[model samples]
Target: MVVATRELPASGYALEVDGRFKAEFATRDGARAGAEELKKRFPMLQVRIYDALTRAREDVQLPRA
Candidate 1:
């Protein structure tokens, strides 16, 4: 399933899969790091980051394209 993350101070990263919450983190950067790993494990899944406070979403860019 595709995974997404919402970074927030309280939840850190409200991780989701298939538009449903799956996990949580402690920091945005940490969540970004987690998303990196998620991309590696789920190569076909498109992972992204979202701002929980402002409701902003950001796509996760992999290294070396």
Candidate 2:
């Protein structure tokens, strides 16, 4: 499993798996722990996790602008 994370301006963190939906955390430590837990639970999923803020920024906007 591959876990990734990014820090938010509000002193929190965002986490995700396999480039899917994200989970917000109160702190980076919490995010790391969450990612590790996910890996342990889904060891065979080939997880690719990342933070929400950066990912959201990169994602396409809705409503076609």
User: How do the predictions measure up, each by TM-score?
Assistant: 0.64, 0.50
Candidate with top TM-score is 1
Candidate 1: C-alpha RMSD after superposition: 5.2
For candidate 2, the lDDT comes to 0.48
Candidate 1, lDDT over the whole model: 0.61
Error of 1 at 8 (Å): 10
| Candidate 1, 1-65: lDDT as tens digits | 22333434343455554454555666787778877888788867666665566666566657765
For residue 27, model 1's alpha carbon misses the true position, in angstroms, by: 0.6
List model 2 lDDT by residue over 6-56, tens digit each.
Answer: 433333455545555456666556766766676677665433333344543
lDDT of 2 at 61: 15
The parts of candidate 2 lying over 4 Å away from their true place are 1-11, 46-65
